[model samples]
Target: MTTTQDISQLYPNALWNWFAQICAIPHPSKYEAKLSAHIQQWAAEKGLPVVVDHVGNLIIRKAATAGMENCKTVVIQAHLDMVPQKNADKQHDFVLDAIEPRIDGEWVKANGTTLGADNGIGMASALAILGADDIPHGPLEVLLTVDEEAGMTGAFGLQAGMLNAEILINTDSEQEGEIYMGCAGGVDAEIRLPLSTENTPSGLRQYTLYISGLKGGHSGVNIHLGRGNANKLLARFLAGHANELGIRISDISGGTLRNAIPREAQCRFLIAPEQVTLLNQRIAQYEQILNSELRQTEPALKVRVEESDTQADKVLSLSAQTRWINLLNACPNGVIRMSDDIPGVTETSLNLGVISIENGHGRALCLIRSLIDTGREQVESMLTSLSDIAGAEISLSGCYPGWKPDTSSPVMKIVKDTYESIYHKEPDIMVIHAGLECGLFKKHYPELDMVSIGPTIRFPHGPDEMVNIKTVGQYWELLLAVLARIPQKTA
Candidate 1:
């Protein structure tokens, strides 16, 4: 059978080998027990001390190398769980099937599924360091948290004084040759619109409207990419033509994760037999419009319609359908504000990630992110007002704080100096628009100094996710240099 040894032969064997093993396990967010147990077993085989905290966070401790014991303790952190996303036609089950990894040119990708390189690569790096024989470092603690994608449950539940490390190096950032000092806060907004359903009218034919092929991506990172949101596009079509076409909605669903832009949506509708031709014409026209609008960002955008033989059990009331359409059209999406302090950075943004109809009720999920709490609150308030007017009940949950950048951080200086020394150039230091666990860790460890770094990963939280192979080597080298340079504790 294939093993990690075969995969590790390409390059950066230590890191890639560990990543290969990780991909062999199904560790989707909130369902990581098997992967956690695998990690515990590996630690046991290596004779290392490991513990699982009350919330399932894993911590593994490694002693300092010779002559480096006087340095202050350091923590290397990465999340264990991954966001599960796959292409519409891909048959892999995230809960049961392992991700199939392949090398493409200079990057490592999966077979029409998210490669999980966002944190998987980071996790592999930490594991490689822990298992190394010659790397010089102070006492090292590897923190592997769970359920970071669906929510920051692991980071939130971390008890105070659970870790004694004064310095934390987060291996979760996506870009290489950059140091992330801060990240935005985020909140999940859920809206439920009540609906009433009735028997399908006789002589009405059933048809399914599909919106697919949109280039969905991370809501925070790709919000400004101008990619089409499938839910919004479908909603616009239905809302625009419902009254004229006498459309009756039977069911609607789109998207799965709150952090991923919806890539596909399907809606079943009932209409008079005579309206089928006209509806098809309108769908084709709308598809052309979307193609023209998103051609630059999403050349593969598709909108298709097909007739169904089976009849729908029930259809939403005309009034409820209209309200649902209006609600989707009214909801604000994409970037709302730009940062004045950080040029070219999104200050506030929102993503309409999910929509579904079940049991005569419609639900929509949105993720709102902002660098400032005021900006986040403003968007939340706006959503609340919009939902109220649409007669929908809205609730917020899984709110997490933002990390404020510290320009004068000692750890930042050390990392920057190490990067310049190795590459003969200064590394880009900036704050990200996406949420990071550093924010939650800061709340628990007020005195901890933290920074995030990682290899170049692209299109995370989606099927297009991939990691640059060469950058992994660079990142590993830089991390080791930083570890060796950690300042000795003061007497």
Candidate 2:
């Protein structure tokens, strides 16, 4: 009974070593060139044929084992990039500083930053198999894609016929006991609310009203958890009293990534000196109301008002302030629809993920996701209508199709059986709410059967991300068992 959580000494040294090596390098989304090069170099050293596509996806190949020459060629897919998120006090840079991972009680986590275990653990398992010769398997191909966090650039740009594997195993799914057969499609809506400044009103004092201590998680996976969204909460206070109290905005900033639910948000604004007491009262009142409303979901939710001496010559004009505050309050967040076909599965949702104001312009980004195209369209149309009515400009980007679930998938059956054999029970076979590259891969390789599996990871795309250590060993063992049990290619 080893109770060590240090990943280095965790069971199965090869896989953990690979993950540790990855953490030493900065491979944040849109900045995977270094990690890509490192993998390519490792492949070259091992004499395996590695190809880097125009979009920077890596396909490293290995020959079948002695007795499995007739088995189906397998493609194990994992993304190379991790979402870059950090606590406000954490001084680590995603593009420059390496992630410092440590052992918690039962999980491995980073120091006030994302642990990168979402796909890093999966990627490491693939590399472990690729670097080994004793693992029994058919022809193997590891498709390491880039920019999977910010966008599915590598998966979308993957050229057809590049991989002849009849089956693909995606190592990006979150939980260990559930095997993902499909995933949602998504589109990002970017809002640009025009800004104009008016001369500061007289007899005003500056203050920063902030919402913090919210436990934000992945927008797609945790949207239904009813956690408090800092951006929306901050807007509620301002929206309720902006006009009555004449709260002139100086600058507003919240959330970091469009794919992450905003954990904390703050606004720096000006108010009449006499209204300071009233503003404090409002925040204290609202904080209690919010905490009660979200006591079950967000236990640490906090709202505060602090006096500030920050300089500001002008604030948003009355019209701009009204529109911005209105849009924030009206924007929809959280699960909008539930799957009628799949019980307890989210069918459609929207996350008002990031909001910021700078350089005379304010921007708010919303990410829409749905299991069906019509579901996504309905939300997009609704967002467009809201933006238009609020006099805000909106544009849609990064639109990707959903991975429709196939209940009769052959490879999924194999994976399920393997999990049952290992754990003495059936694994949950279902579609995921989050976007995986499988949708894009299925578009390019319609004949290819695919399934996603991974170790248990919690709070991805944020600073609190952690991976369950025990599940990593189980996930690795199951992946190897599935490969060894892969049925022979049929003529």
Candidate maximizing TM-score? 1
**Each candidate's lDDT (Cα)?**
0.91, 0.91
Q: Compute each candidate's TM-score over C-alphas.
A: 0.98, 0.97
Worst 10 residues of 2 by lDDT: 1-10
Q: 1-491 in candidate 1: lDDT tens per residue? A: 23334557656788888999899999999998998999899999998899899999999999999998989999999999999999989998999999888877888888889989879999998999988898899999999999999998999989897897999999999889999999999999999999988888899999999999977989988887878899999999988898888899999999999999999999999999888888989999999998888889989889999889999888998889899999998889999999999988899999999999966679999999999999999999999999999998999999999999999889999999999999999899988889899999988799899999999999998999988988999999999999999999879
- Backbone atom clashes (below 3 Å) for every candidate: 0, 0
lDDT, residue 232, model 1:
92
lDDT of 2 by residue, 164-254 (tens): 7999999998898999998999999999888899898878888898899888989999988888889999888889988777789988989
Q: Considering every candidate listed, which one attains the maximal lDDT?
A: 1
Find the 10 residues in a row with the least total lDDT in model 1. Answer: 1-10
lDDT (Cα, 0-100) at 161 in candidate 2? 81
Candidate 2 structure lDDT: 0.91
TM-score of 2: 0.97
